[model samples]
Structures are given as structure tokens and as C-alpha cells.
Target: MSANTDSQLAKRTDMKLFSGEKLLVIVSLIGFALAAGIAVYISIYGAIILPEGNAESAFSFNAAMGMFILSIAAILPVSGLSPGKRASVRWFFIVAALYSYAVETIQHLRGINPRFSQVGTVVDQIAGGLFGVIALLIVIATALFAIPFFRKRQPGERPLLVLGIRYAFVSTMIAHAAGIWMIVLQSRYTGEAGNLIVLHGLGFHALQALPVLGWLLERSRTDEKRTRQLIHTGGIAWTLAIILIGLQTALARSVFELAMLPFLAGALLLVWLVTVVIAAVGLLKIRKGSMVQTNTVSGEENRDLV
Candidate 1:
């Protein structure tokens, strides 16, 4: 087939798979349920039953929410893969999600932290190691899936969405680095006040935040040039925020400290937030305009019928 024909064919295949994307949805729902269960458990016990200095509630809540958001975000890119690749990747996510839930819930219930727990039994340590391995696998898989986004946009592909995905993947890699740093140090703390968990959490959220910005811009009926500019602004600001946070953590300084680095990072985040608000406002205006037009047409039709 010609190159154009090939693109069209791939686009059709992607749409078909996108419509059938259910496994990831199921996995995301399961993650939500696990998170809810954890919340209920915490409420009933009034504590997470972990050692001092360890925030078990944060750990468990973050894990569950991470799985949920990751699975939901995976649906789009995974469906863009070939049929065989899609099935394999989908199953990999399902298994990983399940393993993560089991390890996190079981370890917490046993009064053993699932990650970086030095005082746990041999089994707990082994489970922690396996969790790290699973994390590595997920990173590799996400990197691989990101490849398609960097390629030439296929027919019917939204350029802004692809661009946002590329940015999101890069930010996610940075976040993963924070996670690895924690693994190496065997703690989430760097200095007296620097917390790697803050960096890690912010970094991972790029996966959702950037893409949603792009999606909102795309649907707002903005011109392509303006849309691209807005996306670039938001993407760069978000990335800079992550980098600044990482740098502060690496310097063993708290990101919230009264320091220049923290100030710049906070400012970048605000810039991104402003862009998102702009896109959201544009979308609302478009929707409102469409509704008024539809109402006007309905009134005209009613007059004709009368």
C-alpha cells in the first residue's frame, strides 16, 4: 500500500482497538476500588499501623492512585499499538496492577511496609525487591509505548495530543528517576527537609496534566498555531517545574523552602495552571455558543411547524 494508504489503515485499526479498550478500564476501576478500601481501612483503624517516621497512609494512597491513573492513561497509547502488541501490553498492565495491589495491601495489613522497609521479615524484603522490579518493567513498557507518539502522526491523529504525550513521557521518566533515587537511599528523604516523594508525585502527574491540557486545547476549536503555542507554553512550564523540583531535591534542599529554586518552580507551575485555565475557558465558551445556536435552530423549526 502507498504511504497514505498505510496511514489510513493504521488509523482505522487504532480506532477499532480504541473502541474495544476495556481491559485497562477494568484495571483502573480495580485500582480505584483498592484505593477506596484502603481509605476505609484507615478510617476504621484511625491509623496505618506502620512504624514511626513512615507515612503508610501516603504510601498506600499514592500507590493505588498511581495504578488507577496509569492504567487509564495507558488505554489511549496501548490501543494505538498493533493487535498482538496491544494484547500483550494490556495483559502486562493487568498483571502488574494486580501484583501491585496484592503486595501493597497485604504488606500494609501485615504491618510491613511494601517498600523500603528495613525492619521487615525476609518475605517482606523480597516483596519489596519484586516491587522495584515491577516498577522497572513499567518504566520500560511506558518508554516503549511512547515511541509511537514521537513518530510521524498517522492519519486522523491529533498533533497536539501526540506532542503532549511526548512531553508527558519525558516528565514521567524524570519522576521515575526520583523513585530510583529513593530506592538507592532506602528512604524518601534527602536532607533534613528535602523530600523525594514530593518530586516523584509531581513528576508522575505530568502524564495526566499535560495531555489533558492538549485535549482541552484541541476541543476548544482554537487555531492550530495558537493551540501549538499554548501547548508548548504549558509543556515547557510543567517540565521546568519538574526539573527545578528535582534539582532542589538533589541539592538536599526542601522544594518548599524560602529559596530561589522553589520560587522559580512554583512560578512555572502557576504559568502552566494559567494556560490550562485559558483552554478550559475557551472550551466552555465554544460549548455555550453551540448550545445557543442549537436553541435558535429549534425555535426556527418550531415556528415553521406552527
Candidate 2:
């Protein structure tokens, strides 16, 4: 087939597949239900069945649950877009979740971080090693694929949707990078991480946090321009907050430390200033574009009248 004919044929196939949109919705819904169900089961089991001292096992379990949630959340909306794009992003998430499930299940059942354990046999150690590598790859893939959502697009696209997607990406990328770094450092030398675990958990949650906040903002009957500004401002502030927490953790300082309180207050002020600057710049650019379009429309109307 000629190139044009091939393109037309491909487009026809996509249209036929996504025409009803019902199947995609059903698939996403089923995935969501499965994730939520597993999450609930795990939570109850962790609280009731598991012994209290197994910190590593608990972390693994929670990470598995979180990955499942993140995968479904990230895939559902993206599925509504172009099918090829949806397939690429969706598989990345789904595969990540599946891999996490395997690794966490192993950790809980066997009780070993294969990299550190001399007790485990070769197979177990190998699986543990594979877990870390797979996790790193998944985080990298998620962060990279999420970039397209941040790019400027037509006006009708909801600002909240864009901000939520980008925020999820940024937060996950940072959390995973920090976590992988911590793993490396631990392998090299056992170090006390004052609040590294707490920091990482909070940072990772921005995936759900900022996105839900954006969704709440969307429900307000605010002006679209104002909403966009709010999103940019809120997202930047959220990023800064996560960074500060990570930094404080790296310094071996707890957020609740008496000395850190003053710095935390100062950071809040800085966040406010930075958010204002970013929001102002976004508003100005939006205003300029609106004026230019308005002028063009007015000119065309005048010509018609004449």
C-alpha cells in the first residue's frame, strides 16, 4: 500500500476500536476495582496479621499497593487520548504494577532484601536484585512519558488535568530517585536516615495529593484563566515543598526539630513569593495571547461590516 493508503487504513482501524469508548472505560474501571480491592486487603492484613517489627516487609507491601494505585490513576485519563499513546503509557504503568506485586510478594513471604541477605539462596538474591532494577526503570519510564502532558495545548483542555498529570510525574520521579539513591548508600554503608523514609513517603504521595487538589480546584466556578494560574502556582509550590522535605531529610534533620521550625516558616514565605511570580508570568502571557486574538477577530468583523 502507498503511504497515504496505509495512514488512512491505520486511522480507520483506530476509529473502529475506540468508537464506542465503552471497552476502554470498562477496562479502566476493572483495573481500578482490582487495585482498590488489593489495597484494602493488604491494609487489613498488614495491620492484623503481620508482626510489628517487620519494617522492610511493611515498606515493600505499601510500595506494592501504591504502585497499583498510581498505575491505574495514571492510565485511566490517558486512555481517553490517542490509542497508540494510551497503549504506550498504559503498558508502562501496568507492567510496573505487576513487577512491584511480584517483588513485594517475595519480600513479604521470604523476608529478605536479596541484595543484603547472606541467608537467601542464589535464586532469591537474584530476584531481589531484579526488583530494584525493575523499579528504577519503571520510575524513569513514568517520568519520561508524563512530559507530553505538561506541554502547552489548545485552550479547552482543563488546566487541572494537565497540572495533576505533571505533578504526579514530578513527585514520583523525585521520590523514586531519592529512594534508589538511599538504596545505593545503604548498600555501601549502613547509615541512619533521620527522616528519609518519612520524606520519601510524603513525596511519593504527591502523585495523589496534588492531583486531587487540582480536581477540587476544577470544581470551582472560577474563571478559566484564574484556574490555570492557580494550577501553575499550586504545582510549583507543591514541588518546592517536596524538595525542602527531601533536603531536610538529607541533612539528618527532622521536620519537627525545634531549630527547623524557623527555616520551615521561611520556606513557606519563599514558596508564596515564588508562586506569585510564576502565576503572574502565566497570567500575562495568557492575557497577551487573548488580546492578539481579540484584535484579529475585531479586524475581521470590521472588514465584514465595511
Candidate 3:
């Protein structure tokens, strides 16, 4: 009985795209698309259609957030899973996402922006703290699952996809923390909450962007080793960029408004650039060595044949 069960499990493991995977993927894609569309629509038509002080606009924004959060929760279980592999962490993401949505909903309904709320001045502070802690936990979980790939890749895991997920999670974590801190500590600091909230949104949405990039790269038929390297570099660079943005906002500055911390943001970008150059050079050297080895093997085979 044990042997039969083991054999069946092995067969399932070998199969790709198990039942519901395709559907889940589709749902994820739709959710991402809707989120993007809503964002754009709000940006362009927001002032006119759902102008500030409009209760309807607040409701609309909260509704969109609910949809976005639900979509994210749906994908969380499937994001790291490969065929037949038991989910390592599922309920954590779901609970976190749901709790975050609930808190945000309350704040939105109250017409108080979570990021702009003063310390102890409003109920939004409570919501921000709760949601911020959850986001931080998700970030930690993502790092534990992702950052170790510096040495080797996991079984049934596409290193690139995992890296993307990790990048997005970390970005969201930093954004959340920064927002909560502003509310709790820097309420007197009078830079617009829009800057901080924008950073948070960018980081949170990386979950969609990176995974989509991975899918496109695969479809492009790029070399596997190169693809992995590209994804790794991109993920790292992207995460660093977001972190830099978070730092700037934490300092009460807008994105790219680095006059407040003149050299810091540029220095972060420079560091990322240097890291990318180093990675590219290393990849070139490895590829060169591989070519030399292959040519040497071919010559040896030819001499033996002669």
C-alpha cells in the first residue's frame, strides 16, 4: 500500500499544470489587469469622477482595494507551488491580505488616509499598525523562502519567479512599515501622504509585475541560464530601487526629490548598477569557460577518431 501511494505521488509530481493551476493563473492575470486599469482610471479621472471629499470616491477606491487584495490572496497559495508539492505557506498570506483589506476599508470609510494619520490622533493609526505588522511578517516569510537562493535553487521552483515574488513582498513590507511609522512617529512632518502612499502602492504591485515578466521571458525562449541571471539581477535591482524610494519617503521627501537626502538615493541606484555590471561580467566569464571546455572536448574526440 505504501509503495502504491508513493508511486502515485511521484506520478503527480511529474505532471505539470495540475487541475486548477490554469484557472488560478488566469484569475491572477485578470486580477492584475483589473488593478492596473483601476489605477490608471483613478489617476486620470479621479479628480473629476471621484473627486476628494466625495464619499462615493472613497467607496470606489476601497472596493477596488478589496478586489485587488482578494486577487492577491487567491494567487498566494499557487505562486510558490509546483505540481504535487504541498503548500509551505498558504494561510499566512490569506489572513494577512484579508486583515490588511479590512483595516484599509475602515480607514477609507473614515475618510482618513492611513499614511497621513497623526500619532494617536485617529483610529486609522490602529489600522495602520495592524496592517503594517502583517505586511512586515509577509516580507519576512518571503525573504526566508527567497533570499537563500544565493547558493542554490529549490526543487520545483523557478528561481526567477521566486525572486520576483520575494522582491514584491519585500517592497510591500518596506512601504507598509514606512507608512505606519509616518503615522505613528512623523505625524508632524508635513510632506504629502501621497508620496508615501505612492511608494507603498508601487512596491505592493511588484508581485504582479515580476511574475508577469518571468512568464514573458519564458515565452521569449531566452537561454535558461541567462534567463535566471537576468531575473535575479532584475529582482535585486528592483527591490533595491523600491527600498531607496521607501527611504526617501520616510525622510518626508517625495520620490526622486532627493534634495532632502542628496547623495543617498543616487548612491543606491549607483550601487545597483555596479552590482549588475559585476553579475554580467561574471556570467560572461563563466560562459567563456564553458565554451572553452566544450571546444577542448570536441578536439579530443576528433583526435581519437583520427
Candidate 4:
């Protein structure tokens, strides 16, 4: 019965996505749903695992719920997006979501907690990684794929407010990805997991840099060089952050500090989080004053033989 209902629901969803005039709408809806689901999972997990009085636990529960609400609010508008943006960007989001799923599944199987070395910490890390991955995947795939696609397809399709809506979505995605890196760091002490952790961490956050390009794509339209520059700069920053993390993990000599190598990792996590916010907000500011305008020649109505 459940399987049948799920299939039916999926069919309904496909119909809505395929038949809908605006692909962006479908993209937004999917992204929104994905984000909301992550938030719920996190809130539940925190309530169950962490003690009632833990600040991180309580804050995460609150944060997840707040983010879930924000996702729904962001998804409300699906009417004004272009078709090209819809399919390409949406596909990117779906792929990213799938990739994150794979990453989390692997983590669950192999993820460890040096602090406890017990089943409880292992379970917490696995669950947390799973929940965090979904949120990061949706946010990034949408911005990196969908936003740029939309900007190109209908360069002047919507107003500044609309563009800002797009940036807000992207910003949230970067923030979530940055947060997930904290989970990645948990597994870094293991020599075997170190490389994988750093690789995935950088790869995931690399998507964050892509948004600066997406925002630029919206403004310059065809200035591929400028877009490339933004993406390149973002890539450099992304790589450096990963290097900082990798060096910290690889070079640490002692187990130290309650068995949880705290010195460098904690500092790097803080740096990563701060930059993530800065990048998100920077894109938002660059998109300021972007108005919707159509292109038309001043005096060429009936004849066109240029």
C-alpha cells in the first residue's frame, strides 16, 4: 500500500514538473522540499541524541526548523523562470543531491568519532552527515546549475527582487555546505579517512564558489570571461581552505585534548564558516540594483536588413 501510494505521488509530481510552464518553479519546489526534509531530520536527531541542555543541540534543532521554514518561503514563486534554466539547473541539483547521498552513505559505513570510539558517537556522526548532506546538495546544485542556466536563457526575465531571491537560495546553500564540513572534520584524524575527508570537503565547498559565477552570469549575461574569473577566484579560495584543513589533520602528532584533535581543526572550521557567509553575502550585494529590462532597437519596427 505504501509503495503504491509513493509511486502514485511520484507520478503526480512528474506530471506537475513536466507539464508546468515554468521549470524554475519545479526546481524551486524540489529544492525547497529537500531543504525542509533535512531540517526535520536534524531537529529530530538533536532532540533524541544530544542532552536536553546542550547549546549545540538546542541551537541545531532551532536552526533546522527555521531553515525548513525558510526553504518553503523561498519556493513559493515558480512562475517566472525560463525553460533552459529549469531543466539544466534542476538536473544539477538532483545530481548534487544524489552525490551527497552517496557521500553520507559511505560516511555512515566508515565514519568514526575519536572522542568516544563508541557506538553512540558513530551513530550521531552518521545521522548528522546524512542530514547535512541533503541540505548542502540541494542548495548548491540549484545555485551552480539552475541560476546560471536561468540567467542565460532569459537574461532580462525578472526584476532585482527576483534575482535576489535566487541569491538568497544560493547563499543558504553555501552556508549549509560549510556547516557539513564540520562533520567532515570529525573523520579527519584517521589516516585512511583524512584524504577522503579533505577531498569531499573541498569538492562540496567548491560548489560554493560557483555561485559568484552564477550571480555574475545574471549580470553580464554573455561575459564568459568575467564569469570565469569569479569562478576561478572562488576555486582558489576553496582549494586554500581545504589545504589548510588537510595540513592541520595530516601534520598533527598527538591525539590530544579529550581525544578530539581540537587545535587546528577548530580554527579551520571557524575560518571556513566565516568565509562561507562572506561569499554568500558578497554575491547578494553584487546583485544589487539589477532591474528587468527588454532589448529592442530604437527605430527598427518594420524592416530588418542590417
Candidate 5:
């Protein structure tokens, strides 16, 4: 029985899409399209579709969030079998995406805004803290499961992919926290020069690239030299940008505040654009039949050793 089970599992592990990763890429494209469409649709025609002051007023938020959830429904399928694989992280992404929608729903129900409320203030400061702990636990679980696969990764490879993504996620969470702080004590933190605050620009977006870096590092996707170069350059750029923005955010003069808003927002948006482009490049490389060039573990190496 054990032998038969192992054989079956081996077949699944060996499986790859006929189109390689294009299958997943197509799914991602569709998801993004649907999410954008849903968001725009609701934003533009919502008042016409759902009358104001009716119970339907909040429906747009829920509906838009639902659409976002649908776009990533492939999360479970993406994770495949095992807790440690990219698929597992992919699944967590699905959870995060869905939870984002759920949070939005809760926000709408709270009944107070032309914009989103901070989770820390309205929900519980403890809620984000608790959720982070939970996410860390899940990451640990997935890492343990993936250890076998990860062990095969190259020793010298930089995890730019994973680093990028993790940073992005963390930055966003911190963004929410900062926003909450700003809202709760708008007077003190809003215009105050003395208060310490991270710049709200490229820093958050730059952070997104960390997870991508980590995943790349974990997978041993490319040359050590090239990876190191990427990390050094990208990290420096990200750091410098973050510091500049943080400084601006923390110490911009009162009159210049509104003027700086667009630049700040644009900087963050640019970071996201750069991150997305990197992911696209990664996908392109995979499609172009690039290999990770790791000597530590190859199909033959792992097959014989493991």
C-alpha cells in the first residue's frame, strides 16, 4: 500500500502543464481582467444600479470584493498537493485576497466612509497583530512541508522573488496600520512634524518584491552572481526610495503636504508597476524554457538521493 501511494504521488510531482506555466498565466490574466472590470463597473454604475440610502448602498463594496475573490479562485488549484510548494503559498494568497474582500465587507457595514477605514482602529489593533501571527504560523507550516523541495534549491541563489513579495505584503499591512494611526489621531500624526512615519511610496511597493525574491531564492532559479546583482541594485533602489518617501511623509511642511500627495501616490504606483513587470518577466523566462541551473538538486540528483 505504501509503495503504491508513493508511486501515485510521484506521478503528480512530475506533472507539468503542457503549456508549462502558461496555463497559470492565462488564469492570472483572466483574474486581473475580471477584478478590474468588476471594480470599474461598480465604481461607475453602482449608483444607477443600486439606489442610494437603500440597503443596496453597501452592496457595491461586497460585490466588488466578491469579484476580486473570483479572480483568484484558482488559489487552491495553484497550491497543488503539499503544504510547502509554491502552490501552498498561492493558496495563502487566495486566503489573503478573499480576506481582503471580507474586510471590505466589514468596512462597508461599519457605515462611515467615502473611503476605507483602518482595520486596526475599527476592527481591533489586536486583529492585524493576531492575523500576522496566524499568517506566520501558516508560512512556517508551509515551509516545513516544502523543506524537501527547498533543500534542492541552490545554496548561493538570492531570494529576490520571495523577498520582493514578502516585503510587498508587509508594507501593505503596515500601510493599513499607518493609515489607521493617521485616522485615529489625525491631528497629532496627520500634520505633525515630530512624529515618525515611514514614507508611503515606493517603500510599500518595493516591499512586494521581497516575496518574489524569496521564492526565487528558494527555488534557485538563476545564477548566484546575477541574483546578487539584482538584490544589491533593487534593494538599494527600494531602500533609497523608501527613505526619501518616509522622510517626506514624516517631515513635509504643512503647506507642501497636499502638493506631495500625488508624488507620493505616484511613487507607490510606480513601484507596483515595476513589481508587476518583474513578475511578468519571471513568467516570460519560465515560458522561454529557462532553467534554475542549480547543481544542488536536479531531477536526476533528487531522484537518486531523495
Candidate 6:
């Protein structure tokens, strides 16, 4: 087949996958709406109606935001899958998103913590237990969706993006492990100084951070070898940072405490940040160069027409 024909076929397949992503897109929008509503409500009432000492607004808001972020992150991975696998994962996302939204919104409105509430009734506890199950389902779905990225690069797949996604999935799994730890302990705190939530939150964001870096690098027109090296540098740094943070948390020490472990983690994070900045600069330069070249071509064409 002609290269043009192959390209056209790939485009059609991509379009079909994109169509399947609509449900997830809608779910993400709902999450955003819910988060906005909760924020507005909190601003208006200032916790007057919320249960005392529980930070209901914050919990509800964070839940909504998490749904939104995860849905958005899932889109690319879902699109990378075969049609049958894509459909299954897509449905799993819908179920998990809706379940989370309902449980978080309802429980918070009823003056209970959905994940951990000593004062909640039996039903509430059941719902919280179900929430944990849903979380495990999400982790499984994510792992399935991530499989395609690890397979041999298909025709037209961007190398850097795939590498970034692999790293992101690994880091996200670590984040999920941290979440499971919280579920087992029934607390977000590890000890006097440690807060597992910090590790959880930071680890989850590797999904957005590393993949985005790879996407940007793909467009940056940097050398292929250099781009791959940078992605590896960033991914390794990010993973090491998460590992250090996890170890610190497990040791009952604060992630930000003045200690060697925390300091090493901070330095690794800084290294990742530096790589991101470098990629951003490369992207900007390439875009600027492209714009100038386009303008030049336009001017030459105009002269030819005249």
C-alpha cells in the first residue's frame, strides 16, 4: 500500500478511538462542574453548614478534581488501545467516575467523610468500602490501558510519548499503593510527622507531568537521541523522587523535614523540573522558527503571484 493510503487508514482509526473518548470527556466535564459548584458553595457559606472539623468542602472538592484529572489523563491511554479493549476500559472509567462522584458528593453533603469516618453509620461504612473496591478497579483499568504503551512501538507512534507514558504508569501505580496504604490504615497520616497524602498526590501527577514533557519534546524538533535521553532523565528523576518520599513517609518522617532523605527527594524533583524547563524552551524555539519560516514562504509565494 502507498504511504498515503496507510496514513489515511491510521487517521480513520484514530478518529474512531477519539469518538469513543467522548463519554470520558463528558464525565470529566461533570467533575469540573461539580468541583466548581462545591467551591462556590464553600465560598458562600464558609463551612457554616458543613460538618464541624471534617473539612467536607475540601474533601468533596478534591474528589471532584481527582475525577476530572484522572479522566483527562485516561483519554490518551484509552485511545492507544485496540477497539475492543478501548471500549471495556472506557466503560470502566465511566463506572468508576460516577461511583466516586456520587459517593463523595452524597457522603459529604450528609456530614460524613466518604473514605474515613469514625462517626458514619453502617451504610456509610459500606459505601466507603465499596469506594476502595472501585479504587482497585481503577488501578486495574489503568494498568490495562497502559499496556499498549509498553508494547513494541506501532507505526506512527511517537517514541518519546510512549516512553513518557510508561514511566507515568509506573509512578501512578506507586501513587495507588500509597492510596491503598491509607485505606488499610483508615488514615491519611502515617505517624507524628508523616502525611501519606502528600506522597499520593505528588505521585499521581506524574501522569500529567511526564507524558506532557514527552509530547512537548516530540514537537520541539530536538535531536531524537537527545530527546530520549532527556525523557529518561526526567522520568528516572521523578520516580526516584517518589521513592524517596515514600521511604520518608514509611519511616514516620515528614517529606519536607530537614533530613537527607527528604533533601535527596527535593533535589531529584528539582532535576525533573529543570528537564521540563529545557523541553519548554526547545518547544518555544521551534515554534518561533516555524512561524518565521511560514511567513517567509508566504512572502515568496505572494511575490511569485505578482
Worst 10 residues of 6 by lDDT: 48-57
Residues 1-306 of candidate 2 have per-residue lDDT tens digits of 788777665643443322434433444444445445545655665422332123344454445355435444543453235657766656665565556655554454455553455566788778768777876776777666666676774333445655665776686777776778667765421245355665566566666656654555555545778767766666676777777777766676665566664376347536645644554565567677889999999999999999
Model 2 RMSD in Å is 10.0
Evaluate residue 53 in candidate 2 and report its C-alpha lDDT on the 0 to 100 scale. 27
Question: Compared with the true structure, what per-residue lDDT tens digits does model 5 show for residues 60-156?
Answer: 3344333323322322222234535555545554555445444433333343322322433644444445444544553454334333332332322
Backbone clashes in model 1, listed as residue pairs: none
Q: Please write out the lDDT profile of model 6 over residues 239-268, one tens digit for every residue.
A: 999999999999988988899999999999
Superposed model 1: Cα runs more than 4 Å off:
1-18, 48-55, 58-79
Better of 3 and 4 by TM-score: 3
lDDT score of residue 270 within candidate 6: 95
**Residue 91 in candidate 5, Cα distance off native in Å:** 7.4
Models, CA RMSD each: 3.2, 10.0, 9.6, 14.4, 11.6, 2.8
Over 55-100, each residue of candidate 4 has an lDDT whose tens digit, in order, gives 2333333333333332332332332345675555445544444444
For residues 185-237, could you state the per-residue lDDT of candidate 1 as single tens digits?
A: 88889988889989888887887888888878978999889999999999999
For model 3, the local distance difference test gives 0.53
Q: How far off is residue 3 in model 5, in Å?
A: 20
lDDT (C-alpha, whole model) for all candidates: 0.77, 0.58, 0.53, 0.42, 0.43, 0.77
Output the worst ten-in-a-row residue range by lDDT, candidate 1. Answer: 52-61
Q: List the residue pairs that clash in candidate 6.
A: none
Task: List TM-scores for all candidates, in order.
Answer: 0.89, 0.64, 0.52, 0.32, 0.41, 0.88
User: Model 3, 1-306: lDDT tens per residue?
Assistant: 688777665644443222333343443344445445545655765523311122333444344444445435434443544433324444454455456545544454444554445433545566666666775676576556444433354344444545555556666566556545545654424365326565656666665655545544444445778767766666666677777776676666666553634356456545545544545565567777889999999999999999
